[model samples]
Target chain A: MNTNNSGHSVDIVEVTKTFANVTAVHKVSLNIRKGEFMTLLGPSGCGKTTLLNMVAGFETQTSGAIRIDGKDISDVPPFMRETGMVFQSYALFPHMNVFDNIAFGLRMRKLPAKEIKAEVERALDMMKLSGMEGRRVRQLSGGQQQRIALARAIVIRPKVLLLDEPLSALDKNLRLQMQVELKELHQKTGLTTIFVTHDQGEALSLSDRVVVMSRGEVQQVSAPIELYTQPANGFVASFIGEINALPKARCQKSGQDFRFEVCPEISLNGRQPARLELKDGQMVHIFIRPEHIEIAGPRHNGANIVKGNVAAHIYQGTHTQTRVNVPGIGLVELRTKGAAAIDQAPLGSEIALSVPLDEAVILPA
Target chain B: MWRQTLFWVIVSCILFYMTIPAIVVVMTSFNPGEILSFPPNGFSLRWYEKALTYPDFRGAFRTGLIVALISSTLALVIGTSFAFLVVRYVFPGKNLLEGILSSPLIIPHFTTGFGFLLLGAHLNLNQTLTIIIMTHVVLVLPFVARAVYVSLLNIDPNFERSAANLGASPFMVLSRITVPLIIPGMAGGWLVASILSLTEFSASLYVTASRTQTLPVAMYNYIREYTDPTVAAVSALLIIATMLILMAANHFLGLRKILAIDSH
Candidate 1:
């Protein structure tokens, strides 16, 4: 909203990218505010990386424009774009030591030797890699190499930092560690970052605003919580996290609530979304999170309750995922924190489940 | 255990059979007499002295060194540029160009030499160093280019894009990133080309003049002239030199990388 933020904003206007025969990215328009960590979240072949490459000037858009800080860089080459991209492989120059790798950009700019040294030192210090300057990239561990790659990119003070699945190469623990470092790095340098990742959990944890994409189209763009709680359509709901998609059901309108009738004769009184104008028997899809499906207790006669036999129990360290097979409603999964659900809902035992859609995403089938 | 032992014995025997000729040549270089005999009666350095001092041998060595240096350098430049073109771009006649350029590796050496000889004669370059050097370059080009091409393929393309993203011009990215990474391949290719050029005989016989003859051609001519150990002495020295060069290259560049051999 302010001039300071607008000064560094990136405005992508109807950007479309195509390969020889395939349209990789459809017309996607989004505005990224300054200093915001915006992430493009999608599955593989969803055009997130292609979109990032277009912004970085590695690939030019077939149509439309990409403006970085209000300057259209469609005709500008990659080197002149002033955008720093950390590649998926880290792409550290294997021939050079860490010092030279970090100083490469400065050398390309023909900076004075003294200033270059100071800048390299500051960057190394910032990444907590001050002593690793003389080490070969092959000698360093994966996490260390990742930090050095970041140091190399940020040392240039690029207009916008583009991260192309940089954390995807690391192990789970290292990935978590780097995610924190990435968040802190974003805060420290206030560089508007456009991150592309297929990991939905990472997208949820990292981004200030998440753009959910599917099949080269932007499905929804909102805050991570809003993306989960209020998905614009069916694709965004199924993508953002673990969700149990209920089978097609006819909607029966009550005064304020809507009842979804299934063959098993279970009434579902869920909040009717404004986008869906329901007649008497209009089919609608119901999506509920694994955590939302709770086990029914005694003295529970709710309309959304259904009976299903527990099919499987997968005990994760933090939470247990239970798969329930309902005859007419198909299979629905439930998540319960800790190992309680594994014993509470025994396999092959009939258990009543309360499928709540009060806070869930309900869309037209 | 018996079968394994027998298999290894047979393998060693076959290897020894293949190496017997080289061993005989090396042993004959130390023979004191004019005619070579197995397990020489007396060791002498006279043949080596004679081989090193002979005017034709000396001249041929000098000419071979010049031809190897110039031809290998030319091959490295042409081969690397060809590799860059073939690997980076797809155009009309790409396959045809590749096939024609790499044909020397498959075509009979004498045929290629004869073709070059005729071409040189047409150009009024007969019996000249230029003709010999041109033949050597053409013969060794496929090897050098293949090495550089493998190196280029192994290079992550992101290295260049990353360099470009960091404010490097197209030339700067190439000079700083791409060139440095492929130096080992270039060195390996140059070494192989030079060694091959120095020792090439079949092709040199057709293209090289008497004055511009390489070491291998001169040795062949000497063999036809007299039954002496002088050619044997020269062959021994060349074998040792080649072994040393290969050992040095392996130590420095990990020849497996240049050869595109996976260790596992």
Candidate 2:
């Protein structure tokens, strides 16, 4: 990885925030590299926005410190912190025209009139809003207003650009379009960005590193692929995507592989993970994505085959999700490619499903 | 259709009943005769000319305008700060403070006038512009506070955060964002308070020793002492001035837009 080492890096150390009797953030520590796109992903009321606000200096942390570059900014006010933010509501000044809204920061800095006009024009051009400099904000659509909000923030060339779910107001198609534009904008400016969102798809797609937060603590901080493939815990796994969880499985080590008895008449062999230690007769749960399960032939030769009947077949646009009911084991959902599973595995038909050892993840029950 | 017709009839009747006295007074201002009468003998500008040139009437009109201007301006400032405190902060006695500030609007005007009369004498502040302006501010501050508070509530709180993050200091955010957005409400408050102060009579009558009577008080005293068309002419001019002020205010800040605070 080529990490840029020469820009503003935010270091949040053991920060805890509380509002009256409720603790919003608890001892959260994170390091965002210079010029890296870091995302805080969580549900509502999970303190993601609170953490972003603390970094932007809108809310002071109850305890601990936040540093930008090598200097501590705990005492600095928001205006002095030199961080630009796009709010969730896209809070553009309704009284000002597009040019004045984007030129506000430059005017606040007391820049020369020529410089202010030049900078504002450049920002407008960059945001594809060059001809809209004279338009009132109230006349703009939601997408146009969103672009103006970004233009206003980026015109200042702040040390770190903070976005608080700036795309949440757009429609689905517009949201996808803006998501692509946001990634391109990040690459073009190469500014350190901290984004807060509740959408896991947005976090996984736009961020260099994703921080999954639950309640008031960070559950895991990893790359998108690592978070999807090797989640740190049950919360991270379920939050990132769908998975079939087989709890109450007993495991026994056999050489390099471990045999797991998932349920009555359903014994399966799997390789033990190198990082996790296991003992004989230990209770564990196995998680596998529905797409990883495959249909085995009647005379299957693999040691992972199990006999079950196709209970249901749900036809999605690009794929079919089939639920197979094993006599001893519970219903196992399998995703098969487009319209194929319906003809092959009709309802109430006997079928053989195979669970590959490498695709299954074993966790302590 | 019958209900609609009856509604229109009743509305027009009420309107005519409310406006006939003012129409009669305006018509008397144009009376050619010296005595004030509903139907004039002939049209003339003699009474308007006399009323404009009258020294006491001129002095009273000037005093009323100046006092209203200074007092309403002060009331706007104080009421806006009070609104900020009530909307944005939490502290002891907040509700109590609001209740006390709004007491003048609830209490009888004559009772308030008598109360201020005793206070002014005790403080040796009678017959002074300071006391008059102070009293007018106290009387009209509730209107300003209510209008400004409604506007403040309608403003999205994120706008301030966005400004702060864009490198604006607290004072700059206030001057650049908060104040400009609420100016419509402030203008509404100023106009209502100033008009009310200009027409104030009971409070000024009780407080003014000799030199500081408002226009309404001077008009009342003049009508009691003598009978002529001069007073009607003065009333006509005051009405025209008020109409002009309303037009100017509407031109600057839409009157309907400012009063639409409750809808927001």
Candidate 3:
């Protein structure tokens, strides 16, 4: 975390937006550093796209301020903001040829004829669309048209680039490819980029920092690994990845050590527990990763283990997922390595699930 | 099955009844005999020649062409602006404005014609080409505006927003994107206005001066005074001109596309 301030790339200061009587965004303040790729990730109507639009100046925030490169641009219209946007639908001009569409901004600025020609050629080359200059936009394939739209936006050399779910319309394979290409493009251009998407995978894979949002509020903003490994709250934990939460039955404390009686499946081992303080008979929640549970292991004394019948085993190619039913404890999921056939876990067969006591994290219920 | 057959037969008969007069007009235009009859004595081109050579008919044709051209172009400009304003902006009384603009379509042409005649007479503008053109603009503006309004509604506002985000000014978006995309609608509106202006009778009869008589007014005058095949020849010529205009419109801008916009 290089926190030694590089001047803020794009600053949204207490920005609020409202539509009619409904509030779309409320007092959202964030600072994006220069050359940083930040994504606003949330579901539809969560105001992620609304915030992006305000940054692009296509929308006016009800209050607060927005600035790009330290200049207040809250009142500037979209054309004067000098920001480029890639729309979700790749709104290429249907009547214009590819080269002309890319050159539209330069033409609007009344650039010299020769300069416009050279710049359009350079943009086409940058987008790997050199030979597609003369073709009409509608004749191009989806991916090719998407590139043309990118070229059209970047040719102006804007201060910031805003992408609103730019890869959403593509098929899965092309979407993956585009994600890599867009990340590379961001690095190459070093432009302050604000991407808006509802896809957690896209936000995690491409952004330098991801801002998770829910119900029109920022939930968390961190690096992808940090967000996944140590979520700030239960909502973030569930939203970022899968986690199995178990209810705590009791807790005991000695000096500075605290121990909790979690799921009926787990029991404490002999260890020095002489620190921390917690009351007994207190209910709590324990968070554990599915892969931490060990199946078909040799029995160890005093280990956190539970005996249960294998209710269901699903074959998922790289790993086998099993649902085990323990009496009075309900069902728990365990994902083990290798194929289901190789694991040889039959339905209704008795099995023992074991996990290290230290691996489970107890949180306030 | 029998009822279906009967319904289709009745529809076909009605269609034939509507087309019979047009058929008779064409037939009389080609009649070799001088008299205008239901069935032609023989087929010839002499009536066509007579209609073309007649000085009054030529004058009236020229007047109608000029009036139609001026009225249609002016109406298209004013009507499309109104349509865009109504569709895109939020202003007080927008609905009222739209209703007032489209009122001409609902009002009978004769009522509009007589109202305009009385207004023009009081304003010392009666029996003049300017008044005729003004009245045509009023009569045809509603059709043009309604056609263009439908087209504007179909276009996604995001397209304009994308253009704005790409550094295009409002004027630039209108010229480079909006106008070109809505051209099919504009053409349809222009064609309808042109046809209406060309064949305008009730309004033109009230406003047209003796020297500025249009084709329909001239045809009315000629029919009342004479019973000759030349009148049918003139009517046939007018119908042919209309057909040619429609074919040209279709060839350049597909009629299906224009009709689709208008219907919406």
Across all models, the iRMS values in order are 3.4, 2.9, 3.4
What clash pairs does model 3 have?
A256-A275, A256-A276, A257-A275, A257-A276
- Writing each residue's lDDT as its tens digit, candidate 2 over B167-194 gives 8999999999999888888988899899
Candidate 2's TM-score: 0.88
Return the top candidate by lDDT.
Answer: 1
For model 3 chain A, give the 10-residue run with minimal summed lDDT: A269-278
If chain B of candidate 3 is superposed on the true chain B, what is its TM-score?
A: 0.90
Model 2 docking category: acceptable
Give the DockQ (C-alpha) for candidate 1.
0.63
Going through the candidates in order, state the TM-score of chain A alone for each one: 0.96, 0.94, 0.87
Task: Tell me, by DockQ, which candidate is best.
Answer: 1
> First chain of model 3: TM-score?
0.87
Candidate 3 structure quality by residue, lDDT tens digits, A135-242: 977678889989988888888777788899999999999999999999877767777789999888998999989998877788888999877766666667667756
Ranking of all predicted structures according to lDDT, beginning with the best and ending with the worst: 1, 2, 3
Candidate 2 DockQ vs. native: 0.49
TM-score of 3: 0.88
lDDT over C-alpha atoms for residue B177 of model 3: 81
In model 1, residue pairs whose N, Cα or C atoms come closer than 3 Å (at least 3 residues apart or on different chains), thus clashing, are none
lDDT of candidate 1 at residue A295, scale 0 to 100: 89
DockQ ranking, high to low: 1, 2, 3
Runs of candidate 1 with Cα error greater than 4 angstroms are A1-7, A274-277, B1-4, B255-264
